[model samples]
Target: MLSCVVLWSGRRGSRELPRLRPRVAPTSLTRVDFTELVPEPIAFLGQAAYIQLEAFENLARAVATAPSLGAKEGLSAAAGVALRKHHDLIAELRRSGVEPVEVMAPFAPATDRFREASVGADWYELLLGIYVTTGMLDGFFARLSEGLPNELADRVRRILAEEGASQVLRHELERAIAEQPGLADRLALWGRSLVGDTLLVARSALRAAEPSGRIDEDVEPVFTELIADHTRRMDALGLTA
Candidate 1:
């Protein structure tokens, strides 16, 4: 269920239950039409790809305009790697028969809303936002890909496998935070805000994708694990969880 959200978002972009194992498509789920099920997840992946591309491009442009030659070089390297990953993911979606435009259309509003809500005031905040959002999406997708059909699952795995942009962002963030010692607490708060906005957008996305009321029990654990992973990521960044 949460994988659906993760996969769906992958086309775009957890908690834990105690004693809980991740859900496999129950035998009963085998009868449910995968074609019907797959569309939403694919849609998510498309939207996510678009958002990542847009954000990275924006970041690259910003860095290019800055006075720092070193920053520009870092941005160039990271953007090159990130773009390749996104292109590959998009190509895989096409091979899987996903209609990129139509699939991604519905998710635009939610993703856009998230972007709007998370507009950072400065470069550091903006960079951290990118890091938090991408990491969160990637973590969820990595866990959820297991339940997908092989072809689709393979694409998800590939997309999550890269540490390109986020790794670059983390290095930049560490440097920025080190330079301005007081920025850490403020950025930590900003990170929390990003998590909140992501959940809101995710919930909106789940509702749009699932059109059937609340998420079912099978997916509940996956959501738990996703949140837990998100917390760990925040901690890794020296943010308050």
Candidate 2:
């Protein structure tokens, strides 16, 4: 597919945020589709992406209204920044053929997957992960930017008060496993797949980012490292079980 990314802001004050990090390998992207992009990652961690987006936005607004954490603002404002940049991340990824998983469009359906499945939703930690991951992605994007754009970074810090969605999900999942006992194996296996698939697909983002703009080589190594570290954590937690 040959196309140009047109980021036409419908409103003013719509700054052109940081571009994507780098190019992904075409070979890596060849067999993937939008659905495969977001698997039922480790007890459905992929679902957390959308939830966290919401978490940060809520926090941002709160901060704007009342001073908190000694910053004179809440987390909502910060999430706004990340949400705005997420648009760019999608553009950059799609331009090079890394389409987002469409089923997550509203970011609500995934929540239903675990809403009443006996797992208490750890809203807190997932919220935190949302903030942290936003920061990680934002920082990587900024460094890979033409001028090291930090728009995403700002939003991430703003949502700093909250815990990551992953942590919450992990805790809940752990509890579920502890009680079920028999389900542990499945969860652990699923967790491994999530980690594996994430790395495999991640390459496409790298190649996708390459042609349209210049991304720091440093960005990929860092991103890869983060994913690996995250995967290790999940593995230790037995997410697949």
What lDDT score belongs to each candidate, Candidate 1 first? Answer: 0.61, 0.37
* lDDT for each residue of candidate 1 in 122-183, tens digit (9 for 90 to 100): 87887777777767766654544444567777767777687666666777788878889889
lDDT of 2 by residue, 173-215 (tens): 4555677765656544433333322322233233334443333
Best by lDDT: 1
Runs in model 2 lying further than 4 Å from the true structure = 1-147, 151-153, 156-162, 211-224, 235-241
Q: Which residue segments of model 1 deviate by more than 4 Å?
A: 1-41, 65-67, 204-213, 216-218
Cα-based TM-score, every candidate: 0.72, 0.36
What TM-score would candidate 1 get against the native? Answer: 0.72
What 10-residue stretch in candidate 1 is worst by lDDT? 1-10
RMSD of 1: 7.9
